[model samples]
Target: MNAELHTLTGAYALHALSDDEREEFERHLGDCEACTQEVRELTATAARLGLAVSVTPPPEMKAAALRRISTVRQEPPVAPAPARPVAARFRGRRMARFALAACMAVTAGSAGVAVWQHQSADDAQQQARAAQQQSEQLAGVLAAPDAKATTGQLAGGASGTLVVAHSKNQAVFVASSMPKPPSGKVYQLWFNDAGTMRSAGLMDPSQTTEAVLLSGPVDKASGMGITVEPSGGSPAPTSAPLALMNFATA
Candidate 1:
């Protein structure tokens, strides 16, 4: 894409581009990752700007403006005049109105940009907080005095370990040497509380050695199992478990 086309990024992000312009920019976006990321950031910013409160015009404002316009005489067509500087053409009220309009346009655009920046900052802060919370949870689990770890062999030569914090009703699982599931299928973890089985979470197929934070109540669970299920996972195990580990928790 041409350098000149890059200038339209802001307008494109704001959805101000014409149809043809937008189509061309979209094609350019596929090849240009930088531009694609910029557009995404600007679009998010625009969304934040849209949430701002707006002032309503007075009820009679439109009628009064139309009446004033009706009273003004239309100018007659004349031969083309020599080009003059924009500042040199307007005088008195016309000049004031033009300046005021220009100022308002600039202010509005700046305000929108400002709102986008503020929202971006807020999102970063929220992500940071979430990361900190996750770290703290993991630390607490590792530090538990009664936590026990056990390893067992799974089907297809896979091996897995389970670390449980019985008193805290929490557990983490780490799997290795697991075969990839068939297309449209994923491995899911399950916890057996008494005789009832409940889903924990799905395993990451891409990682040979992966750790997962198990869900459901661990204190009441007598055992844990793993089974292959459809991609989104199943409410109940669809097939026989490939691995099962019984826990004797206090």
Candidate 2:
């Protein structure tokens, strides 16, 4: 078995071989069990890869490739001469195909990276917009003519202040030196709606000192409370309140 022809399994699997080379390889495949097995495996892998590659390479990468191609000097025309040996021609074409495959792999990697970068940028933008909206709502509540505040102390020297604006029907909860919740738990805020407690919002686990705009209307609630609930929070308080503040007295 020719080692050179054995190597052609890759080119054949990729359909990179010329018609004559393909015919020769196919004829060779009849007697070569190893190459037959290799070709079968390579062909399956190529089919799988063809279906997987859908991301379009960035435009800048295409432009750069075109620029590189433009810079390559074309070989000058030569007087008619004897043709090179078929083996030598195959070897040269094989090397060129290998180079092309390497380039394609790099381009594919770049496409993946570009997709990740775009996703990161989109995530950052969404976070920024949310922050801006929260800030505006906080400002509206804090500056309301009827704005009032009620403060309460927690067990671990932590404190929370609830600011309510009856005119705006909005409320904001500010925490300072807040301790981390127990493992598998989170801090949840609630409004004392008449006698029933209604969920306001949950505090971010990552922040120790931060302000949150409570969810839903605050006009009916006469007080606010904080409690430790399971992760993702419960619809109702699962335990006693860590701290409570009376909005009616404030």
Candidate 3:
């Protein structure tokens, strides 16, 4: 059983093992805490590795894929925040946000091409790059220390909600429930520190959102608000927020 441990990894990390193999590994791990730790470490590492990649997974495999992610070797823990914060809490939270966003960024960015396939052929080749741009914008906004999460709308009807939170170092924005913007006019985002509003990024069509996460961090922002801008994005918002909220910090 000890010699067979290595054989169980690839399948175990992805949870692809047969019943007997899984049982054997479980029993082996019970007596050998080292094996349990090894498995956990390997899974975390795998998930982390996968996060940086953009492979659209099949639309139907969302749950299985997310579940498997938690078990992967290189991935970090993506569980909900705990009740207490530790010394490394900032670092841990940063890692968690990036890992989650990175993974979703790939999938959501490409719209089920990488996340579903991870890199398999048959996915969109052009890369729904437009969507990727939008996700990147969301990440940028979330990183603001004064960022807050809530529902929003543009003058035209672009709508969604993102959670904006942060610490002294940076502001982070996480969003979902955003409808993809209209064709010519995108649901653009903006950051208004005081009176001047700066372009954040384009919002994807809201219909595509799936409770996926979006994040970003920025400096020199005392307060923030999202607004609708032109398709290519404007240096400043052309219209007011369809849905707006104040930063908790602000």
Candidate 1, superposed: residue stretches over 4 Å from native: 1-132, 248-250
For candidate 3, report its TM-score: 0.37
What is the TM-score ranking, best to worst?
2, 1, 3
TM per candidate: 0.48, 0.51, 0.37
Using alpha carbons, what is the TM-score of model 2?
0.51
- Across residues 102-180, which tens digit of lDDT does each residue of candidate 3 receive? 4533544322221121432212222322323433443444434354554456334434444444553333333333555
Q: Model 1 — which ten-residue stretch has the worst lDDT? A: 110-119
The residue ranges of model 2 lying beyond 4 angstroms of the native Cα positions read: 1-119, 248-250
Deviation in Å, model 2, residue 73 alpha carbon: 68
Q: What is the lDDT of residue 198 in candidate 1?
A: 93
Candidate 1 RMSD to the correct structure: 21.3
User: Higher-lDDT candidate among 1 and 3?
Assistant: 1
lDDT scores for all predictions? 0.60, 0.67, 0.45
How many residue pairs clash per model?
A: 0, 0, 55
Task: Score candidate 1 by lDDT.
Answer: 0.60
TM-score of 1: 0.48
Tens-place lDDT per residue, model 1, 70-164, is: 89999997664589433233222244443433343343332122212223434544443443344345444544666666778888797776777
